[model samples]
Target: MFIGVGVTIAAFYYYNNPVEGESCHIQKENNVAAFVMYGSYFYLFLQFFLARYFKVRVNADSDKKKKVA
Candidate 1:
């Protein structure tokens, strides 16, 4: 994930600093970079959400009345 984001940032910088007289394709680059960044963030958020949402109980409940000892 970090590698992908790093590459996207590098590409954005390169597009903004293209060779003189060469087409930078800034519009296309911006669109692709925006979607890539958004997708990356959304994907990470989903993973964390799912992990918390489906957490399993490995230990007994912590109620004082429920103590086995």
Candidate 2:
């Protein structure tokens, strides 16, 4: 789904901004889109990291309690 959206957006960008002669650079908005996309991916990674961190902490506490008992 994400791949489709990315490809569709890229197609529209290239269609609107075709290379003429010398300049072949993407528009400023296109660069911003790239950053936004990466930001979303980073957010997902952060969520995964936090979930794992808490899970490990909970397991360690449980193990310590069992050993004390």
Candidate 3:
């Protein structure tokens, strides 16, 4: 996804340039936030790969049973 790509770019940029000696490794909250962001992106990309190459459907975008009332 474009969002994930953008986040990845931002992550790389920040990692290369820390804020006044503060960083994900030194800040507890920053570490947690970084982990969560990267974890989510990794999971999404992995699922996409599996779906594309292995015919795995993690989540359906539409329900066939839906009806207009």
Candidate 4:
């Protein structure tokens, strides 16, 4: 998650800084690109965490049920 966030931020910073653009010119003016990139990364991380958490919970529950039986 941290790595994803770091990479996304770094990419955004690089995109925001254009080497040859004029001071008043804007390259990525919509800002949707950054939002989409960051959002996708965040969503992927969240899904991963949730899947792992649910898997652990399910295993623990099954173990408890077997012990009780």
Candidate 5:
């Protein structure tokens, strides 16, 4: 997913900007790259949070069963 986002953003920039001119274009590309990277990282964090929540629920259920037994 991260690679896909990066490629899509890169292709958009490459098609819209000339490859042979202007250093500022590089800066714009860098900004886009940074955004994609951060967005991907944020997505991973959400996934981690969800997984942890589910894991805690499962452990609580197991502990409850052990206590009842």
Candidate 6:
């Protein structure tokens, strides 16, 4: 994931700016790809965090109490 994001960032940076002595500029497709990539990563992280930290636990014996004679 880190490598993918890093490469995407580098590509986006290179394409989004006009290079010196060159006519290279950002393209609509590249911009869209970058946005979608980041969005997907955000969704992945959100799902992982929710499942790992907010998961519910079931206890079947919680209602049973000890009787004192």
Best by lDDT: 6
lDDT of 4 at 29: 47
> Lowest summed lDDT over 10 consecutive residues: which window, candidate 2?
22-31
lDDT of each residue in 1-69, candidate 1, tens digit only: 667667666667767688878876557657596767768897988899888888785655666547865
Decoy 6 TM-score against native: 0.52
Per-residue C-alpha lDDT of model 3 across residues 27-68, encoded as one tens digit per residue: 446645766777798898899888889995645445543533
Per-residue lDDT of 1-69 in model 5, one digit per residue for the tens? 667667667766775775676443345666677777768887998899889875645457779899999
Candidate 4 residue lDDT tens string, 1-69 = 477567556655766774676442434643456567768888998899899876645457779899999
Candidate 1 has a TM-score of 0.46
Clashing pairs in 4: none
Runs in model 5 lying further than 4 Å from the true structure:
1-26, 54-56, 59-69
Better of 4 and 6 by TM-score: 6
RMSD of 6: 5.0
Per-residue error (Å), model 6, residue 29: 1.2
How do the candidates rank by lDDT, highest first? 6, 1, 5, 2, 3, 4
Worst 10 residues of 5 by lDDT: 21-30
Provide the global lDDT of candidate 4 against the true structure. Answer: 0.66
- lDDT against the true structure, per candidate, is 0.72, 0.69, 0.67, 0.66, 0.70, 0.74
- Inter-residue clash pairs, candidate 6: none
- State, as a TM-score between 0 and 1, how close model 5 is to the true structure: 0.42
Model 6 spans > 4 angstroms off: 23-27, 60-69
Alpha-carbon error at 40 in model 6, in Å?
Answer: 1.7
Cα-based TM-score, every candidate: 0.46, 0.42, 0.44, 0.39, 0.42, 0.52
Positional deviation of 15 in candidate 1, in angstroms? 18
Put down candidate 6 lDDT per residue, 1-69, tens digits, no spaces: 777777677777777675788865557687678779887998999999999889895554664443331
